[model samples]
Target: MFLASSAKPIDDNLKNFVDEIEAQSPSLSVLAARQFRYSLRQTPVELNIKEPRQFNVLEEFIIRAAIEFQPPPTEDELASVLGLDSVFIKTTTATLRSLQTLSATSPITVTPEGRSFYEKGSVPQPPYPIQINAITDPLSDKITFQSESLNETMINLPDLADFITIDKTIADIASLPLEEIQKSIQASGLALHIPEEGKIVASCKVVASTQKIWRKISLFVIFDALEDKLSIQIRNGKQILESASNWLEVLHSESRISLQALCKLSTEAINFEREAILKQKNTEIEARIEKIRKEALETSTKANNEIDKSKVLGEAVQLRNGQISLAFSEVLNSAKSQILIYSPWVNQAVVNEKFITLLQKLANRGVWILFGHGIARRQEDEDKPVPPEVEKKIRAIKTPDGLPSVQFFWLGDSHVKEVIVDKEIYLCGSHNWLSYRGDYLPRGESVYKVTIPHQVQEAYEFLANRFQNHAQKLWENALENRDFQMAVESLCVRGALGMEDIALKEIQNNNWLELLPVWLNVALQGLKSKNLPGDSESFKTALSLLSQVSIEETFIEQLQQGWRKVIGAIAINNPETALNLLSDEVWAQFIRLKIVQESDSPNDFILYRI
Candidate 1:
């Protein structure tokens, strides 16, 4: 969600803007003034063609210099402008000549006099008539902007309407068989979408030969603008059974034309999911009923199994009081000569640190332990990305299989809690993994992921459906190749559709937004992804439900209280929500942030919907 603001770099006006920020919030003044002085030049760099780390250092030095220094046109300014300390400047300077390339035309190069003045600690005043044009497109991997011109317009990606026409043409095209489409597109492809009136802007293809198993070629159809809904001619693997409108069928008034088919697809997906959640709930209730019945039946029979039945009945009574661990131990102990562990989040923490040693010792004494957990992601970062600090010394362990192990797994929708040992050893209550959460540093205490064997089975089911047993790649924008992020986008935009419809239509084709004229703020924009988990989508749903005024306010509020919180940035562009961020006189910080440069700016950044 990078915004590109147009420039209104009037010298006196710019001076006044700087003066005001500094005067009102002098500290912010130093920080905010970078928008006025520094020029941002970004270009994509593929790994193959590279000049090593020269431009990397230069760019780092500039942003670092800009952010760190006060009244920063000095050596400190250079450091702040780049993202490093001054000690590296000499090496950076030596590398600059070998590094700098003017794909366009060379501007004035920095001379020794300029370097000496900066080296002598005098602020180098920026030359007047600052050249503030943004590098809208990258000529190559590395981009360098002149320090003088700091204000210019940045172009944005196109919308849905621009590239596709689905009403007639798309329907006709998607109707093709797999083989011909593969030959034409030069791959095996799935044509999943068609906009009602626009072009067939987006499509996905499967690489025919040597395509990795389960590997898919995702063709993201980015539209020029938001249309009401696409009218599509539908097909289900073989026959032209129906003509479904590829439209936004306002379920409760969102958008889209084809509601019935969409609903059908979505309902099926949701049914599969809901069955898993509800199954345990229903089974537990039935199991309780069955236990009482069995006890009555045993007493009625008065057979030799009477004592065993009474013991089982006695055990069942303890369930209401929650003696899960006792029950689990009983189950394990009662196992004549066989035992198996079915946990998704089993590590030292769940059973003690001596748990493994104990298990291995037990195994040597003839106990079979069947332990299971998903493989850990293989990462190669020498200096691991630091996790936020907590008082607890959390360290991951290497398993015998050469995988990092942790006692954390999702309960539902990628939750971070656990169900342990069995339905018996339950350890769940108010516990949170957060250390420096919000203003309350190390605030949250233990908010446990409830532990029960049934719950564990439920957790395993959810994980299997979602994670695909593979680690997600680390893409730059997160939006780049982010199939998961695309899911998030759908959850936000499409509201509460059945999981089936959500995946089939919303995610499979349209949700992935493309950045048009990609050179603009690739790095800064890429910084937006956070591993903030939980359903911010549910929040959106709650808000929509509130807008409908369908239920009592108190009821909604109560639901929210129990609702789980997730760590994801609120979709910055929810029309109802985002419209608030766009009222008159909201441009102050944007100006300071270089997001909006001119006061007379009629909003340089425009979001297109298709």
Candidate 2:
């Protein structure tokens, strides 16, 4: 006798309402009872109705209202069509709106869904037949259900909504197991109240359960969607259970619900949430990478600059007065065996104390030291003697042989000033070693270390030979006239007349008196041995000077005495034999007494003596 049937389980309250109606109508026909039962199962029923009416007013109103109003009727118009007062119409429409049977904003037309509900002869198919879709908001602890039943009922279950804790994309939700999802929803405190039914369903079935770890915390959850409700289960690992559910009865009566809309909304929200999260993470990562790149580039640039500076230093070095001391120290310290210094003027005040100390140390180590200064008269208009302190320091230098370790010389004509170290390095420019005082000098000066090998060697050789010649000149100038006269007489006694003739001529001509002693020493040396100190430039120079002098009568007796010895030695065919015949030392006395006569040139002979 039933007009319609469904496999869906009916709520107890709905079944009880039908039972009460059947019990109250004892005279109701079987057909009427069957139709009423079917109606109750598929469509919402008015619990206040005590008996069946000839026409179902609610269904008729919905159908007729939809047909009459293209742009649905106003409340007044709708009331007129139904023959009801405006207040009654308003109240009925509100209920219809709540069920989604009518538009909430209106001309009072029936909803498309509402039309579908009543088209099946007041015995609509089971509502919300499609699967339920749900979304969760973890931060707000809310869950939103997208289902035809939920939308149709306009049920705002704040308690159940509050349970959703996380907002996720459709993909994320789909990928997550239903059990874990249920646990998350339950943890948010899911609960729903059915105000019309005066009932509350706080528990949900977990069709599936799952455990997952997120951010280092274990999460156990259950997720399921039953015919009448969408449910979730949440647990903190093994304890602290929580659950939530959205019941179908709370949203729509057994007869009316829609699943398509719910799925669409849920999918949209999920995609939006996922995109937003991924974009944020990507931006943060990119920013961090940019910062690191900048720092690395800055560091690399700094390193390159330092390397370039080092290269510059290796190629060449420039030094001024302030930096010259350090440069000098490096030059001196690098010396292994030789040090040569040349300065135009010599004075204690001009030389650095540290330089003097270093020189002394080098001298003690047997490193050859040559210190040159301009000739006293050639240095300036006024002659300057080597400072007393400088001489004392020089004299203090000790060597392995107990001989003077440092040789001092005068650069008579050359004005070059430079320092040479071990023939490997050299410094040249305007830096005056003997006169520079970095603090007192107003003029800027520079000294540079020579890097070219040939240049260093060339400079070293020039200075060395010049210093050697100057040293020789100094030693020769220290000899006295008697020293020279004795040297000449020694040669005469040896009957080396050829050499004596050369010496006599040197003494008479070119005022070679200063070098007479050196010449006589060489001649004496020749008489003592078969070979002289070989023919040196110095000996050749002496001979050249003698060639330029004219013989003078002032030395006739001395010359004749020397000539007689030479003649005797040669006649005997043995100079040593003749010299032995003259009784070795006697001729030196005559030559000293006779040859030491007054010179015609007072200027040349003023200090001369025999």
Best by TM-score: 2
lDDT of each: 0.28, 0.43
- The weakest ten consecutive residues by lDDT in model 1 span 216-225
TM-scores for all predictions: 0.23, 0.27
How big is the positional error of residue 396 in model 2, measured in Å on the Cα after superposition?
2.4
**Total clashes in model 1, counting residue pairs 3 or more apart in sequence or in different chains:** 69
* Tens digits of lDDT, candidate 2, 222-296: 111101112222222233223212232223234233222221223243344334332432344344334433533
What lDDT, from 0 to 1, does candidate 2 have?
0.43
TM-score of 1: 0.23
lDDT of 1 by residue, 113-163 (tens): 233333333322222221111121111112122223333444242222222
Off by over 4 Å in 1: 1-234, 238-254, 258-305, 308-398, 404-407, 413-610
- Which sections of candidate 2 miss by over 4 Å? 1-316, 350-353, 375-383, 438-442, 474-610
